[model samples]
Target: MTAPKPRGGDILAIAAQNKVNWSGLDQTCINAIRVLTIDAVQKANSGHCGLPMAMAPVGYLLYTRFMRHNPKNPEWFGRDRFVLSAGHGSMLLYSLLYLTGYDVSLDDIKQFRQLGSKTPGHPEYGVTEGVETTTGPLGQGFGNGVGMAIAAKHLEARFERDKSGLFDHRIFGICSDGDLMEGVASEAASIAGHLGLGNIIYIYDDNHVTIDGHTELSFDEDVCKRFDAYKWHTQVVEDANDLTALSKAIEKAIKETSRPSLIRVRSIIGYGSPHKQGTSAAHSNPLGVEEVKLTKEFYGYPTEPPFFVADDVLAHFHECVERGEDLEHAWNAKFAAYSKKNPAEAAEFQAALATDLPTGWDAELPVFTPKDSLATRVSASQAEAAIGKKVWNLFGGSADLNESTFTDVKDGGDFERGHFEGRNPHFGIREHGMCAILNGIAVHGGFIPYGSSFLCFTDYARPSIRLAAMMELQVVFVFTHDSIGVGEDGPTHEPIEHLSSLRAIPHLTVIRPGDANEAVEAWRTVMTHTHGPVLLALSRQKVPTLDRTKMAPASGVRRGAYVLTESAGRPPEIILIGSGSELSLVVDAKAKLEEKGKSVRVVSMPSENIFEKQDQDYRDSVLPPGIRRRLAVEAGAPMSWYRWVGLDGEIIGMTTFGASGKYEEVMKHFGFSVDNVVERALKLLAR
Candidate 1:
């Protein structure tokens, strides 16, 4: 389809227009993005340039003509969100952000991919003002956009009244063939379609070019048909540069408010590059010196001076600032009136936006005692019920393992089609997509999102988990069946080395509660934590709660590790450390060793990461240097225990897969028993 002609019937005619907004200045602004992208990538001598050049018109139309965003206030809650899911084209987003009057400066664009520069290799969330979430990991951002759509629907249901649209912002994004090909994106798309997330509108960049070669060498499915199968409102703009067609497609999508929309834009890679357009050559590399000049000439741009933006194009894009201010000003006025009518809901909305925990949110949390012998997962469910009631904005679900993971809230209705008011979202069996979506919800603000799965299944969600840690998102990841305790499910279900591997991720706090009360405290810590993602590795098998009347209070969980019980009247000769279900073993072993006239101290070490953050004085007080005989017992790999158990200490942990049997039998077979703990402590003392 051809672009609609200007009023004077010429491509370069300077004329005003209506909603289509087709003009020579619009084309100039679009080319400005293309040229700036080429300059940034060419100057860096690194980064992808193809998609930016190919989809410059697509991106320009969204930023300037369609998307309701505030360039000056990027965090305006009422503004629509735009995700560059095809984030390797970071220069594309940078150019749009700069031209549209965001905080991104010309020098920042010049420092693309440089250390400490806002324009990093990928579009990061906090580093750039307009970037909604971190991208460049392909399908992760796709899942994130769906998550944002979910968040929007949920907030709208809870807060909006009388057709007021305070929470009616849409999630706009540009995805690619690589993104669609990723398994995570497929999973996320399936759920988004199922939930009828009408707030999402993603443009597929069908440029057919990958780093290895054209996508035909790998991807060849009918993308629009596939989305149709997923219940999406699908459309295709045969020409990427056909502005009139693309605009109409998007307008039609906005009218269809029952399904998410996907508009396939058949584009050419390196759209205007003289030598490399429509080829793999321009996908990831700089267009070289001569190709750069030729490309500028192709766009009718000056060749010598790079990163140049015409004054008219700048002025054209800056119009977003005034438009955004007007839009926000009107919304603010409506919100002020809405606040008077619905004062309680308005305050709740503001608190959620600030991520502030309400007072007494945990007032109802259970304090388990020795009489309570329950799986940590079960305790987590109980704690969630109490916190969910007061927190009000705690949203999450399990990966089709709600029955086993025990993350479901009793009264929290299922978040289904047309019922987004429910807090418990059913994520089906998509672990990776669930985590990526949780990141999206967290980054979207006004909600604390979480997802749960079996500990062994976290391997499937590792990439998203790593991204969450990288982004420092406030997401809670709950993983049950934490060890050999998975029992009859056998080695495939058990998580060996999972704890140690997860601990290796920076900014991620991994906690395995020793008992029911510690599980509650872990939830408390998770609710208060704001810096990064936290993973709770809970046990499926029952473990006895410590009698806090006789032992240290469970509040010590905030300290990461504490002396649950120490040798009576003296410094302990031997120290026993454990976490999760294994904590019970050390508690029993400490009792046995004390019977033999040995001074024994038992410490509950739930989170090594959080513990390590403590001051040296507090750390020394917990594990006094004079005592070197330490024994650490757990059902997982011993790699993470070596640091806690010094050269003279011993760690009793699994070196092999667990057997299929009862949980108790399986645990003993893996040497996670009280007898094993006692034996290891004795040997350490003898040494």
Candidate 2:
């Protein structure tokens, strides 16, 4: 394969000159990765083993030569990120992480796919030290790589000055035919290429095989041309085993510097497996005892030793430890010099790297009063603008819903080709990509990312959001047009079961603010939050700002639920509960019931997950014992309300999709009006 002409300086020439021939040590290292992968799957009696065998050379080259990483301190800020998008071949990553000494022990590899083992079915982020992000659902890690690349560029632009390369590093990934086929990767690639994120270089394991059959059966398109259309610089290495050609392709990708790079490395499936090589059997099935012995013989490995690590092979791979230590030490020296030269900027930069927000960042967050003009509470579009002015770590954008979703960071500018320092990133119409990119930014660290779109599109973004929750990423998702209040656009645009569907994801915090002050508190809770991802579902219709002087302060939102209006007497006879746009309807209905001298209570539950975390005593106090006559209301689906309202309690929620009409007409038609709320309360009391 001829080398592509480099567009950068003499760096390409230097890299090519430094490249060495495929040595005996290199082959041993590559074979080690392959054998470890083979042994892992054979021992576990599960997992895909072919892809690891095919991509061993690329893995060896990246970990030992091309990638910049410190395995000892896997969280080192300057280290390059490696994402295995084809995570079914997780043993490959596990092998590299263990060999390079990132905390995965030999025992972990021996226990692949076992319960309570670090080596699970997939590479989970926090469970393993060197695993940068979780991967299992195909294409998620592909899009995550794009997000990491975008974050790297943004930080480089924001903090780098006068050759202080404090935040300079690349994101590398190995994706599969399955990963590229997924729509999320396509969405992320379009935006990544459009924005000229040149720091990403992914190796496509073009092995022409999948779980079902050869990719030719289903996927038969010019992948290189497709990426070219996305403005990516694409290359192909016919032989994945050719170290010289693969190294040249990677060096040129680094030097291209104006677009993301994809190096399609064609490789043989199950290389060295005498019978199974290039066949579907090698894709997932373990080579039987006889076949495994023959395969080892082909590679000249010892057939008797199951998990052998030759001393030389171990030394070659562990060289990464010393190399990494030196690399970080050099960067540390430069960081010290940078700190001395720019003290204040350096201090701020350090704090950002630590993901620390100023103690006062949320101090002046907006406080809405009833006397304040009524407005759509979801219009907290100003949330980022309000907190971002003081905390620079807050940076994000929307998927072309910028004006509508209210997620724009004003004056932060658009994160485009030449102005990556801008906080706002225009994600175009790629909602799935927007969510995945936000996960990337949150995992990349130094930035608290938030992405927005209409609530109905949560279907498109659910997979990435699930991964964020699984990884416990600290991201904020701003979903606007929370309910059918997004009228005139019809049922297609409205979300009926979205609230319940999103709440289904574990470790995800869903907060639907009731009014303006609650919206303010929602954003405040997000600003200092350091746990899993949080979703703020805001409204599009006008919602009344409550009189806090007569009700519980909006700060009660943090507790997930509070008595917005308590009963006139202890142990209320009946309770009315609501959240988001329907909250005011219940508030109005409570007043109507009180006029009849019946004891009544009004509850605003913005977040069910947060409320679940509250002590049982707190929960009982809010809902209380003996108050079995409960009427809960919301504009969305009500399945999740069963736990709070009890089996005997009644819920006022939509049974069907919404209709297109004026906002007020739609609310009245759906029984979200004050009259319907009072009527539901009365009916529950009569029961």
Candidate 3:
């Protein structure tokens, strides 16, 4: 592997000018990114080398020339967001972070893909300084980018005055074929187009290669055409190697303020590799010592040097860091002047960024007594309207189910292209896009966002949900018409596996409240817990509020699961457990069993996930180990109840799809009734 002959300075000049050296300065910086990516992957012995090698020029042009960000204050609200949606090429992002003087260092790069290191195999939000969102799952980053774009537009609308572009910022993402192929991206793209989010720009690395040799093996759809179908503005760069073309394409994208832009950049997978430039081998595995050496030598890098940075190249890259800081500082000064000029606007801006809930925010959460009757969905809407009034930053929309889900913010106007200041978002029938954009809004930082649709429709947003959990984003998903109670909508609308399935995700909390009061409690719980995403599954049918005087207080709802009712004496002959609508059944069953000379206790288990998080003493207090004769009941699948019900327990739940009928008739047909609950409890006690 011999160095290419000098084309333009010293040894550094020779390496930088190899090819595509449009600007000597730009060339040095681009090569610095390329070499850093190669060396990082080579040192770590793991990582995808193809994307970083191929997409370095685009990334270089964006970060160094276009994107406005501060390396020093990574959390700066005014900085433009850059998401590497093709997270497999994390090395590319990490390399840029290291060179452009973000908090990431050469040592951090050395620790790539290692456990406990900030530089993981993929970009992780909150884990690394500059990582916008976690993007290991394909297409999730693109969806998140949509969310960020929405955030930028909304913030700019709310805060940016005519003379002062106070909240102006752009969201940039690098997506691969995998991102375009994923359904979440399509859903998010459609919504982005509909919303006219011009602040967003996505660069597609059209390498046409996947893990399975070639993308042609399975993927052949025209991505540009598809984006066009979604009503997005599109452009194609004939060569990824051409920096000038990439720069001009980005400028055009920035110029268009009516639509989001996608720049399809064509390039080889492993740009400078000697043997595996366009093959599957370059996708994940190392390029090997000989091939890597040859690639570095071919680009005029010193053979003996590893992780080497030429002073001039380092100087050129540091300019980005300086420029980023200056941008932030300039914004800060402008913001300070704006605050003096318009105290009211400045206060609103500061208040939103503070993450503080408005005073008396909880005043609107209607308190329900045992005598009240209401559906959890209705109760949730009441709570939402109350919170929405106090927390002005809270914004969201439903998937054309606002009336059904009760998710509309009262008096809040729709978020349109021209009206970003609106609190309510009309997402139409796009559940997937609603979830993705909620994540984007949350990622944008100032707004507390939520998305709503039927519980069954959660399937449409599953990928986005998974990404939200992975990113530990604080986006809320309000899923109404939970369980068979969705009724006349029939089997098609009912959510049989969704509750258990969403619970299966690692960092997501799935909560289903039993009544109006518990629904309020569920809302309170979701607001207080900020570590990850929360899914609120609400019922469509009215449920009687649990009698607080006769039962445990609604406060225990925060415990996930708790003893809603206690036995008359020391320990009960049998324990009855239920969640959501079925909790009412257990409450009624407890009365009949007690009348029949059986000591019975009913526990309202709203959230199994949160219950599991409690300490054993608390859990034991709720469900004592001595009580083996327990019966768990729910309207949906029964698979999740075994952990609480014990070895001798029985779960009276739906093992099949629901029937078409009224909600009450459906419940009766499914055996989700007091009679069935009493029978199950008696059988357990008899045993």
Predicted structure 3: lDDT: 0.84
Error of 1 at 524 (Å): 0.9
Clashing pairs in 2: 381-406
Residue lDDT tens for model 1, 1-687: 222232212211211121234777877888899988888988999989989988898898899888998899999999999999999988999999999999999999999999999999999988999999999988999999999999999999888899987888899999999999999999999999999999899999987778888687988899999999999999988667778988999898888889999999877778777667767887999999998988787677788789999899899999999999999999899999999999999998999999888999989998777889999999988998899888878899999998898787778798999999998899999999999999999999988899999999999999999989999999999999999998999899988989999999999999999999999999999999999999999999999988889999988899999999987887799989999998989999999999878999898999999999999999888888888888888889999989887887888888888878999888877787778777878877887
TM-score, prediction 1: 0.96
Sliding window of 10 residues with minimal summed lDDT for model 3: 6-15
Off by over 4 Å in 2: 1-21, 373-379
- Number of backbone-clashing residue pairs for each candidate, in the order shown: 0, 1, 2
How does each model score on TM-score? 0.96, 0.96, 0.94
| Candidate 1, run of 10 with poorest lDDT | 8-17
TM-score of 2: 0.96
Q: 85-111, model 2: which lDDT tens digit per residue?
A: 999889889999988878888888999
Q: In angstroms, give how far residue 77 of model 3 lies from its true place.
A: 1.0
Q: What are the RMSD figures for all models against the true structure?
A: 4.1, 5.1, 3.8
